[model samples]
Target: MKLTNINKTFGNKKVLKNINLDFPTGKTTVLVGPSGSGKSTLLRTLNLLVTPECGQYEFEKQKLDFAKKISNKEKIFLRQKTGMVFQDYNLFPTKTVLGNIIEGPTQVLKEDKTHAITTAQQLLQKVGLADYATAYPHELSGGQAQRVAIARALAMKPKYILLDEPTSALDPELELSVLKVLLQLAREKQSMAIVTHNMVFAKKIADKIIFVENGEILYDGSPTEFFDPNNPNQRIRNFISSMTLEDL
Candidate 1:
């Protein structure tokens, strides 16, 4: 995705100002920033989830003109191409694990139930949740629920997965489990954008690191450069200090 001259604001406050970024295909690009720094906002802009007040979203070489009126059908098509995973696992309480996983494809994609169920089973196995397919969300741990969310997103066969603080709610051990799965997915799938505070995970998994602060792109480089000592960005330094403390 190529974002050109992106600008977003909420009332008088500008969140993303003249932001330009290029997200490589089949690569894990992690957006790292402090809270309320617009990392989530920029990620959401990829699928037009939070439509930029002004910008050109060049997705798959097709530019989505933000100024023009977009039809509902076009929005839905964009949604199909992108899958999102939030910090909180948004599973349906009424649906079993398997039921939650198969819901999207069967309902939105209009896929056959048998095929959806079969695919869901494979995804559940992939996420190491095959045994809990019949369990409710209340019965699963935070890590398990998050993995189920990942499986549900995978069921859509989305080209890119946008993750928002994927393990913020989990315990250390559970967070490790989820991070390991995410690293594996990054290595194997290579088409995801993760917004996270996990500096270690970002260093290990991201093909590119986008560091933002004060609602702007402070640094856009490799994880090596992100961790470089000579870098003069004080905000980056401060953020890394906080991340190190948290990781400990």
Candidate 2:
């Protein structure tokens, strides 16, 4: 996706400001920053979950105007091209894991129920939750629910997966489990834009790393350059210090 001249504001606060960026295909591009630094808002804009007040979103040669009126057809088309995994693990308490996974495919994509079940089972196994197919959201731990959330997103077969702090609520071990799955996906060249504060994981998985602060792109480069200990960017250095302490 190519973003140009993007801007978004809520009430008096500007969340994103004149952002110009590009996400290359088959790469893991990690977004990192302090809390409420507009990283999450930028990811949401890709899927149109949060529309920018003005911008040009170029995807697969199709350009959409965020500043103008968009048709329902256009929104649906964009949504079809991407999926998102939220930090809160948005799942249906009333639906079992299999039910949650199949909802999008059977209802939105109109896939056969039998086929959806087969796909869900495979995704469950991929996320190390094959036995939790019948478990409800409340019955699972934080990490398990997030895995189900990732499976649900994959079930859509989205061209890109936008992850928003998927393991923020997990303990160290649980966070590691989730991060391993993400790293594996990165190795397999899955297209994803992740919003995370996990510097260690970001350094390991990122093909490109972007740093956002105060509603603007502060830095965009490879992980090697972004995390260089001798880099003179004070803001980046401070943020990295905070993250390291938090991790400890």
Candidate 3:
């Protein structure tokens, strides 16, 4: 995915300014930045959840012009290529875990219920939540809820999954379990863009790391280059200093 001259402003506050970057396909890329750095805004723009004021986005060779209105049909097609997970597990209050997993496909895409159920079961097992299919989100812990969220995203079989501080809401132990599931997905060549504070997880699974500050990209390079002591970006340096090893 490539973004060019992307800009977004909320009222008078600018969140993204002239942002230009490319996200490689089939690679795990992490976007790391402090609060209010616009990482989440940038990710949301990619998924078309937040419309940019001005910019062009290129996904798999298709150009998305934010200046123009997109048809619902076009939005649906783009959504098929992308899935999003949030820090807050946004499961439906009335849906069981299994229902949450299958709802999107069965409703949005009009996929067969039997096929959706089969895929949902496999994804639940993948996320280590096979037995929680009948359980409600309220009955699960934060970590388990996030795992179910991941499962729900996977049930769409998207080409790229966008994760926004996925494990930030969980405890350390729960975070590790979810991270393991993510790493396993990466090993299986699932492409994803993760916005995270966990620097260590980025180092371990990310093929590339993009550092952002003040609505602009500070650095975009390999994980090794990002950690290199001689890197010139002050934002990168400050971020490293603020992070503890445990945050990884």
lDDT of 2 by residue, 1-248 (tens): 99999999999999999999999899999999988999999999999999888989998968999879877888898898888999899999999999999999999999999999999999999999989999999999888999899999999998889999998889999898889889888888889999998899999999999999999999999899788877789888878888888436
> lDDT (CA) for every model shown?
0.89, 0.92, 0.90
Off by over 4 Å in 2: 246-248
Deviation from native of the Cα of residue 22 in model 2, angstroms: 0.8
Compute each candidate's TM-score over C-alphas: 0.95, 0.96, 0.95
> How many steric clashes between backbone atoms does each model show?
0, 0, 1
Query: Cα RMSD (Å) per model?
Result: 1.7, 1.5, 1.9
Ordered list by lDDT, greatest first:
2, 3, 1
lDDT of 3 by residue, 64-173 (tens): 88888877877888788899999998999899999999999999889999999999999999999889999998999999999999999998889899999999989999
Tens digit of per-residue lDDT, candidate 1, span 160-204:
998989999999999998898888888796599999988888889
| Candidate scoring better on TM-score of 2 and 3 | 2
lDDT of 1: 0.89
Which one wins on lDDT? 2
Top TM-score hit: 2
Quote the positional error of residue 102 for candidate 3 in Å. Answer: 0.7
Instruction: Supply the TM-score for candidate 3.
Output: 0.95
